[model samples]
Target chain A: MTLVKVYVNYKKSILNPEAQAIHSALNRLGYSNISDVKLGKYFEITVDDDSKDIDSEINEICDKLLANVNMESYRYEIVEGANA
Target chain B: MTLVKVYVNYKKSILNPEAQAIHSALNRLGYSNISDVKLGKYFEITVDDDSKDIDSEINEICDKLLANVNMESYRYEIVEGANA
Candidate 1:
């Protein structure tokens, strides 16, 4: 099997309220130097190693469902082994 | 500065419906070979380098607010630079 690790996060140009809240919380917790506390989604997908067009398929899935193209961006890396 | 990367995910013993839904969607999209699609949260926290007890502080923040201990587990790593 192949392990596809995907990380999806809000675009840098966009405003993320959840991230702001977390940043504020960090400050309140006496971590004044803490900054850029962004939040994102991570997915660990396991797939058959023999599949053809795996890269494109992963791109399609991520673009169509895993991430919002306008506000969020996604990237993925494939690992040779599977721990799924 | 210190960059704390935290990954929070549902316990392996628990059922995650969101992950299942995404898996089904992947199958419908002709990725029948895809399996073990698990979802999780990724946080990129930027903090000061001079702080003492950084490890325990990160643990406190993660445990108290970043993760739901009953259903999820969290792990973190600290990088040596700043990208906040």
Candidate 2:
């Protein structure tokens, strides 16, 4: 099996209220050193080894289901032996 | 500035309904090669340069706010020059 790690996050132009809230909360909790915070989605997908063109398949999956594509962008990395 | 990437996920013993839902959706979408899916939260935190002992500070933050230590576990990587 091949393990793919995907990260989906809001575009740079978008204002993430959740991240802002977290930053404020961190400040309230006395972590004043935190300058910024960004919240995103992470997915670990395991695919069968028989598949061909894993890169295209992963991109298609991300585009179709994982990421919104309009306001969010995604990136992925494939690990050859990530059965664990 | 330092960029810390934090990944928070449910422990192996915990049941992840969201991941299961996604897996089902993928199967419905005809991605039969997919074997498993795991979903989690990803955070990008930028910290001020003046902070001393960044490792300990990040650990404290993760323990106190970023993750629920009981059901979820978190790991982080510090990227020194990640201003972009």
TM-score of predicted chain A against the true chain A, for each candidate:
0.93, 0.96
The DockQ-derived docking category for candidate 2 is high
lDDT of 2 by residue, B44-63 (tens): 99998888899999999999
Q: Residues A40-72, candidate 1, lDDT per residue (tens digit)?
A: 999999988778888998999988999999999
User: Which stretches of candidate 2 lie above 4 Å from their native place?
Assistant: none
Number of colliding residue pairs in model 1: 0
Colliding pairs, model 1 = none
Q: Provide TM-scores for the models.
A: 0.94, 0.97
lDDT of 1 by residue, B1-84 (tens): 788899999999999999999999889977889877999999999877777888988898898889999999999988877666
